[model samples]
Target: MQPKLPIQCPSCESSLSVTQLSCSNCSTSVSGNYTLPLLLQITEEEQNFILQFFLTSGSLKEMATQMGNSYPTVRNKLDDIINKINQLKTK
Candidate 1:
């Protein structure tokens, strides 16, 4: 089977050459070169927030409740993340 491409760095937009890629479901190494957007290059906190947002099915109210923050606060953070993604695309 053809190998999947390597994932790229979100900040630098550099292609990540993985020595071993594994599937979370099967724990199999599906090694290859892949490309991803630079926006993935974020701090752990940011990553967690993103993951939580997605895991919560993009429910801002849920995120706010879970994060113990206001709706506007969660929205601001999400907006900031989106802005960063947009900037990277333009670059």
Candidate 2:
């Protein structure tokens, strides 16, 4: 049977290479450690907001309406989330 691909870090979408496994996938590579991006470390509320925005194909007007908030408010929240994600990449 074919083996499954290595697990990926939720934050960066990078593969997680473990050192070992009991099955035929043993002897995995042990390279640098994988760290989750700070954005992924953010509060669940923020993550959910971002997820919803993307699921709606980045429709800010729709997001604002669905969230019962002003356009500026939704825009600011999105900006904050983006800034946080950018910071993660810079690290």
Best by lDDT: 1
- Regions of model 2 farther than 4 Å from truth: 1-32, 37-39
lDDT of 2 by residue, 47-87 (tens): 88988898889999999999899999999999998897787
Clashes of each: 8, 0
In model 2, the Cα lDDT at residue 82 comes to 84
Per-candidate local distance difference test: 0.75, 0.74
Over all chains combined, what TM-score does candidate 1 have?
0.57
What are the RMSD figures for all models against the true structure? 7.7, 8.1
Model 1: CA > 4 A from native: 1-37
Model 1 residue 32 CA deviation in Å: 13
lDDT (Cα, tens digit) per residue for candidate 1, span 48-68: 888999899999999999989
Backbone clashes in model 2, listed as residue pairs: none
Given candidate 2, what's the lDDT at residue 69? 98
Global CA lDDT of candidate 2, please? Answer: 0.74
User: What lDDT would candidate 1 get against the real structure?
Assistant: 0.75
